[model samples]
Target: MRLFVGGLPPDITKRDVEGRFAPFGAVAGCDIVPSKGLGASPGECRGFAYVDFEPKDNASLARCLSL
Candidate 1:
């Protein structure tokens, strides 16, 4: 299952996201959206990201995440 994680710091990195969610379940992938404004820095994140988890671990991990 895929989850949307928002409100992250603009400089957040892929490794940072993966580390946080690693304990929850197996993260299949993590993509941090990049900023696109005129003054946005290179490699700066857009303060949001998508986290992909294995289907088998989705339900239980989702429950824990909600709490």
Candidate 2:
């Protein structure tokens, strides 16, 4: 199941996000995206992610938390 997540802390990583929703069920994967930038890269966080939860309940909860 796929879940969209937003509003995250700068130090937050894919694993961190993955763990947060893990309580719901098994986690297939979590994709944490970075923001657009140039040299030095700005290193800005996209503040969002796509999490794949194995169980339907987890996915549903993740979706709810995303919004």
Candidate 3:
């Protein structure tokens, strides 16, 4: 299952997000939206991200959390 995480800090990294959600379950994948501009680079979070959980039940648990 996939979860949409918003209101993230601009400096947030994929690793940071993974760590935060890891306790709930195994994270299948994570993707942070990058800023758009001439010099915009990857790793720069755009205040939101998409997190994928290995098991659908894990996602449900994550949703129950206050994160």
TM per prediction: 0.91, 0.69, 0.76
Worst 10 residues of 3 by lDDT: 57-66
Give the clashing residue pairs of candidate 3, or none. none
Compose the digit string of candidate 2's lDDT tens values, residues 27-58: 88988878765632354557888888776576
Better of 2 and 3 by lDDT: 3
Residue range 18-47, candidate 3, lDDT tens digits: 999888778888999988777766667778
Q: Any runs in candidate 2 off by more than 4 Å, and if so which?
A: 39-44, 55-67
Question: Highest lDDT: which candidate?
Answer: 1
Candidate number achieving the greatest TM-score relative to the actual structure: 1
Q: Model 3: how far is 58 from its true place, Å?
A: 3.6
Stretches of candidate 1 exceeding 4 Å from the true structure = none
Model 2 TM-score on a 0 to 1 scale: 0.69
1 or 3, which is superior by lDDT?
1
When 1 and 3 are scored with TM-score, the better candidate is 1
